[model samples]
Target: MIDTRWWQRGIFYQVYPRSFQDTDGDGIGDLDGIRRRLDYLAGLGVDAIWVSPIYPSPMADFGYDVADYCGIHPMFGDLEAFDRLVADVHARGLKLVLDFVPNHTSDQHLWFRESRASRDNPKRDWYIWRDPAPDGGPPNNWISNFGGPAWTLDAASGQYYYHAFLKEQPDLNWRNPEVRAAMHDVLRFWMARGVDGFRVDVIWHLMKDADFRDNPPNPGYRPEEGDIGRFLQTHSADQPEVHDIIAELRRVVDEFPDRVLIGEIYLPIDRLVAYYGEDLAGAHLPFNFQLIYASWNAESLAALIEEYEGSLPRGGWPNWVLGNHDRPRIASRVGHDRARAAAVLLLTLRGTPTMYYGDEIGMENVPISPEDVHDPWEKNEPGLGLGRDPERTPMQWDASPNAGFTAGRPWLPVAANFAHCNVAAMLDDPFSILALYRRLIALRRVHPALQTGSYRPVTAHGDVLAYQRELGGESLFVVLNLGGETQRGIALPDGVAEGHVLLSTRLDREEKVTSGFSLRAHEGLVIALSAAT
Candidate 1:
């Protein structure tokens, strides 16, 4: 029998702190706001809440740029507020995971300030710094994820510093022993504070090529893909040495019981699986984001899922992410109807599923006007539609002004459809997407087949994707229609003559299936299969 940890058998909900709620009337979500919503989160049926960063910073990249790794940002809350939120979350039997950003820090950080203060500063090696090229240009051709060169020349120091993102956020030198020790202490500090786990940001970028070689240009790069894609990033990220660093970090997390370390990696399936490390010693859950980028069709998704599952290392667990703060919402990527079907696919997959806040209500991306844009990526590289502000808009809780996310003006504009697409509005409607999510989650919790069962692909035709999850004699069948046209006469897997509908995306179906069933356009169904004779 396989030992299933809480994170492995449970659903994770990502809460974007700046947008989840606002309690101080500051137009920004704070720790207190999250505390006030603990009951709502517990009722949502998620086993864990993975909140985005709330560390002190200058908002260079929102909360991703950390100035103080051990403290909470005043904008979000103080130590008291964070401690209270953690306690409240635990009291409700829910785990809380914080975003751990060890790769970079805000330029305003004391460490960075001390490093750049002078060449003789003890902390000069804390961040990645190098002498400028002979031409007084950047050290190399590496490009920042935001845009342009990754290196920024500091006049006072007469040396270039590397930043994988904006200039305001400088990448840390993980190669330095002191840097590693300090970062490990940061993890210890949080773990001591009762943090259940950490979702490490940009985990793959922790180690860079020691040679500082220039990355080769991509011949297939397209103008529409933005400047960051101009190169293949061969040297800037995903170094083999990263696995060792991850293993070290894993040791720190292991010191605490039942703690998890989820790495945010966006590599190909082959490279992504390597983060699990030999003998499964790396991150507990290197987040699988292929679902977010894969083509949203049955054939494409089927192939992608099969490849991902096959690529996992022995004893390595898998997880799925449909949307995140950095990506477009599901409803916007796929239409609202298809988003419902996608939700079923996400929860029913043979791995842990992470639900982004507001996705339960089918929140679509809101348009961000030029004046309203706050994302540094959009400001640095405009017209590529790479801005994340659209997806990070304030959550919609009700029909009240500003969608009840705040009494004051929201930090970002609320979605235009918030009045109709909100938690409160959907709570009253049994057929709402919110209701469907609740039922699906409830079903997943009660069924062992949906938790740690073996996955087998069922023979599916055309736009229908079919699969089975079975643990012992208990079995569940999942079928989804990924197309816009209704499918009829779909074949069922062998040994499964009929099943009772447990839940449907439409939230209007509950009957026994004895023959080929018809699925509505953009629909999904979870069925409890009868015992095989």
Candidate 2:
């Protein structure tokens, strides 16, 4: 079978819809806002746009706690607007990947409402509900990911409901065949509407321990790590049955042509790759988030990449991510100078690269004041700096009022440097971070080596990570200087006597190398090596 799936080689750009753009002066981004910016996304060269959840919800955990799986949120737009957005995305030859919230539903969802109505209700089994322990307290020691107890008492029903993150976001009982079919049907609803695929949210948390055992304590956890780390989550997440459910989802997605299923799994590399399933029957792209958590050092990162690459199931492709809605912006994590080099590292690596929206313009995390804070996690757990609000701020399109995101107030404040560090400003500057990203993406599209080639780690000394991507006798060497000091006499492999710089993170420097190359502080370059003589 020829593997020509679009997601396999193409790049992904994730947009947090509520902060993307506002079209109706409603102070919130809508589907039309995204529609208006489709051209911008195309110009950026992303193969698809994975918009965060825009479904009807009570705003408990933003759109993750979905109220209706098939309906668009009124705040975002109606079905008509969504149809137009889908049309526009397709019109530009781009794919649309919706955020599929399968693990939980809003308390306001009809299913949840029916389930919590009464113990004898027909829909009572739709969600995870349990009777209290003999002492009349909560069911178990499982704690909510946000904070406090995971079980919530329902006075009206005389039972307690389980939630992974927020009480208002109840976990669905995937052990029930009915719930699995229902969620699969939801995928059908979107696929029928022309959505190319789905990035399933919190996919590993779909099934829990059938016995409802208490999660064992995590001995490595510290007070500063927040309540979630207090337990190993042995009974609450990554259950064995989740693979069956993921395979079912894969079967549903396979029913449609050229569609992809991406699972948002945060397990160790060994366990994370299991989502690929035997014979490649599971998620087409089990999102690799190791880069997001690994130490930003060359030695450690090189080892991490090797481990991930070494773990893939036969015929399984690789993917990479630098940042996301839940994590701090890349610039904030690695600093501005290193972010440019990081871009080269991300795009030049051997996999599908998922870029966060504001990353192209090098947007950092915006500071959110307590008065303006709105993330439910932060609200649930005070003063832990656990809230995602800082990273979910509005995208800075231009240097206009509200950073050109909206005419009215934005849902969150734009990053402080938006005036000069934005698309408009970067478009005109050849050396800007956005230019580097665009250049790297364009380069990747033209070069088969960087697209789906084999990756081989190259040896280089301290603070420098080197690798080569090769296909059909053509090779691209990526050398990154993760440190601040210039490195001299970096040796090229034998038979690779000469090559010219294809693209450099430094932007100003380009050269033809003979035997060796020197890297400046925090610099990276992609060199096209001459075929071995």
Candidate 3:
């Protein structure tokens, strides 16, 4: 048997620090607040915690524009507070993964500041800087992910610097050997501080075309798709050279034993899988986000899973994500009932699963008014509905003022449904979404078939999707009804006559099942199948 690492078999919970818990009553969460919640996370059965950026920043992109890679932001905490948090997390036996934004740096960063100070500055080559086009416009036709041109004109230096996201985030020049060495040292600095892993931010955007070619216009782009989709991004992102850079990053991570490298690549599955590098020397997991964007019907999801599984390179591991800080909550995307069913799908999948901060309680996207909007994406491109503030609201912890996320007002407004849709409220209700997630995770813990077994598709028809996980003769069958109509006499694989119900999304009806069983609307089940007889 192959030796499985801790990341391979463990569940990862993403903690968005600013909205998780606030200790100083400043309407923002901090490191000590996360330390206080370690017990809660341990009780939730997650084996790892992946915290979003808490690094020193100008808040231009809300931590994505990192000003200092090695220091913690004062708003979050100092190095001492971070050390204490790391200690507490390790004490609870949970691995800590930090977000590593290698693609860009805050314009205020010393490197960028010097690079923009003058054309002759020593660090002028640290970031991508190019002369203006013949027409004195942007250097190329590349579009920023946030909005507008990807290049920002620096009047002082008489050059334009490139940024994939916000203008305040200047893209690093990975082609420079010094820049690559400096970034690798950043990883070593954190690994020495005991960070178990890194979820590399936009790993695909690390390198760009050397000639700075203009990307082709996206003919199929629609107005609702927002400004970033206007171009095909053929030259600006997903360059072939990125794999070599990733392999180098992988070497840095491999220096520290048992540390995993997860890449954030938003390309198609075929392109996304390439991040694994030759012989799986790239990212350990490239963050499978198909569930977040795929249609929620059984047929589409079934095909997606099969395609994703088949697309993996030899020995490459798979992972799944349902929601995250940048996407809508599962409950809001698929409705509350189907969200419960989705939880079962996530935990029972063949690889590591990442649960967003408030997803366990079936949190929906909160409405963010213009006055309360904090996300730069929304502020920069108003009324296009591209803002992520709705999905990045404070965690609903209790029924108290501010939902117990903070004593002061939250940075983003708490969801109005938090009064009844909180951890405290759902913990007592066995049928609640929180309870369903807990049961699913607990079921994964005791069943190796559910944790590291092979995934075989049984059938996906109408509203019912069925599959089986088997390892060492232990077979666990999962059936999910993705619609509002009840499914009757769902077909099972040949010779599978009866099985005992191990868990259900509705938290009801446990008994031996045979050929004829009625599945409730928006329900899912995990069954321990009997031997073929």
Model 1, 1-533: lDDT tens per residue? 25789998999999999999999899999999999888888898999999999999899899889999999999898999999999999999999999999999999999999999999999999989999999999999999999999999999989999999999999999999999999999999999999999999999999999999999999999977788899999999999999999999999999999999999999999999999988899999999999899887878888998999999998888889999999999999988999899889888888899999999999999999999999999998899999999999999999999999999989999988888999999999999999989998989888988888988888546789999998988888899998899889876677667899988899889999965899999889998888656
Point out the worst 10-residue segment of candidate 2 by lDDT: 1-10
Name the runs in model 2 displaced over 4 angstroms: 1-3
Backbone clashes, each candidate: 0, 0, 0
The runs of at least 3 residues in candidate 1 whose Cα sits more than 4 Å from the true structure, single-residue gaps closed, are: none
Model 3 lDDT, full chain set:
0.93
What's the candidate order when arranged by decreasing lDDT?
Answer: 3, 1, 2
lDDT of each: 0.92, 0.90, 0.93
Model 3 — TM-score against the truth?
0.99
How displaced is residue 386 in candidate 2, in Å?
0.8
Our tally of clashes for model 3 stands at 0
| TM-score to true structure, per model | 0.99, 0.98, 0.99
* Better model by lDDT: candidate 1 vs candidate 3: 3
Q: How big is the RMSD of model 2?
A: 1.2
Q: On a 0 to 100 scale, what is the lDDT of residue 181 in model 3?
A: 99
